[model samples]
Target: MEWLNKDVTIYDLINDHYRLSLWGLRCINIEKTWGLCDEKKLSEVIVGLIDSGVEAEHEDLNGNVIEGYNFIHNSRDTCDEFGHGTNVAGVIAAKKNNGVGIAGVADGVKIVPLKVVNKNGKAHIMDVVRAIYWAIENNVHIINLSMGVEVISSDEMNLVRLAHINALKVAISKAIENSIIIISSAGNNGEDSIDFPASLNSVIAVGSVGVHKVNDTFILEKSEFNNSGKKDIIYAPGEDIYTTFINNTYSHTKGTSIAAGFVTGIVAYMKLIDPKLNQEKAKELIFKSAHIISNHKEEIPFINADNIMISMWREKVNK
Candidate 1:
């Protein structure tokens, strides 16, 4: 194929923080997967970022952001008042090789900035459900949810809470039925339980892994604040991640929220390479290609972007 011998290096990797700020990207081996396809095709992959909102004018995110609705105020303005959405968007699609800020995992993919949360970092369950249905209607390729409702004790589960959960589940089911990949952060609570939406069976759950240098070599360790569960969860770099911030600036943040963005960015590329890819196949490839952080099978595996991309590439060509 044309991409096999394509000059990948032509795509700039020299953004100001490429070396220093993008420790998470390096950990996932994201650079090796660049230039694997036509940049224009990659641009067609859209990720619906359901969060507070995005600063559309942010230097690193301006052109890469697509129009989306603000469910909070029922307006067109998606400016991120809380700044969390901008952080996650930066982790997923910050401009590459701008020689300005840090680069994202999939620089070519466009982000659909859906505002489901408010400035106080609070989101209504119905708002999130509406955003998912909106994304399904818009036919986005992926949905990256960096926010979720915390899991409460079983004794506290009430009919109202269950009804809300079911509402989100139904919306998520419709998205998946339309072949939209939904990924959510496991949680930042550091508990053994995953958060809602992510805890849903069909959604891909992502946890945070901290990158540390041990004896001059980097290692992936589970972040203390990353929530864990027994099933269908993966890990990615989260600690000290430097990405785009509001006000056309940048900052370092950490959480499973950032981790979910990393997976979403990688999955965007996978969808680009294999348009036929769906939730089941994407999750299979992700879990199968993941690197085991420890010897235990139950330990959440960290994402290996290079491995999964190559696997997807081979599958595309083999067919």
Candidate 2:
């Protein structure tokens, strides 16, 4: 509560951003609803925030951040102008129980902000490609991409406008070759398909789930804009999740973008438990720990971050 910026009045700090973020914490079991992970260990993972930059000086995130790049403006200032990147990073690694704001899903991991999306919320495909490579070169353990563009094939790499999409294919493939875990948002179109990168085989496509109360039965329904398919898709709480915002503030936003951040946190925490964990093994643990939201009506498998640690313990005891 001390570091909360003076600009963010004490009342606003508790009412706006921090208080309502409990959905994400509960979904990930940061509160230990299942009586797990008592120690709250610090993780060694370095997560890449590849979006609209971040407010590196924010009270909740300043300490855990590393020097980042701004591919959009080609500068050293990675401060967020659009607020989305800070929000995503806050979901992934905002310091826990900091008194001023809500905790992130995986605390203790470093965040490397890569400014790909611009203040206008428009990002060139080439900018995104360069940011991914920059993050890879910096040796970040995981790259969380919450944005995507239409697919472009190798044959169409010279459309001037569509060229970057093709180049991104190679960039993404190289990142995977180096064994970096890439987690992306399932396209927010309310269709059965995701966009490129997310639809590709190499990345974990994340979809959003909304906590809905209908007719006295609680239902974890898909976000209205969530895109779904069998392509490595995972669902997490995303609808109107509260997160850090620019100007030392907070707000609630919706879509698969928020869901992707939670999944990235899960990956980071998994790596912390087992330093040798790779992209393939992490995916396995996540899928194995997922729970079916509604088997009788909806078959969406929602992630239970609390269960992964429990599963690991059960196996250890059985041995």
Clashing pairs in 2: 1-99
Q: For model 1, how does the per-residue alpha-carbon lDDT over 1-319 read when each residue is reduced to its tens digit?
A: 1212234332346555454657677678666688565666778899999998999889888888989999988999999999999999999988877777888888879999999889999999989989999999898999999988887765788988788887888999989999999999999988888998788878899989886555665556788887777767888889999988889889989999999999999998899888878999999999999977762223557898889988888877897
Q: What is the C-alpha RMSD of each candidate to the true structure, in Å?
A: 4.5, 6.7
Candidate 2 Cα deviation (angstroms), residue 152: 7.0
Q: Which candidate is the best by TM-score?
A: 1
For candidate 1, give the lDDT. 0.85
Tell me the TM-score of each prediction against the true structure: 0.92, 0.86
Residue runs of model 1 more than 4 Å from their true location after superposition: 1-12, 153-155, 213-218, 295-299
lDDT of 2 by residue, 204-318 (tens): 8899988766776556777778776668688888987877889877778877888999998877766666666677777787888887666345777777776777776676578
Q: Spell out the clash pairs found in candidate 1.
A: none
Misplaced by over 4 Å in model 2 are: 1-17, 31-43, 151-158, 295-297, 313-319
Full-model lDDT for every candidate: 0.85, 0.76
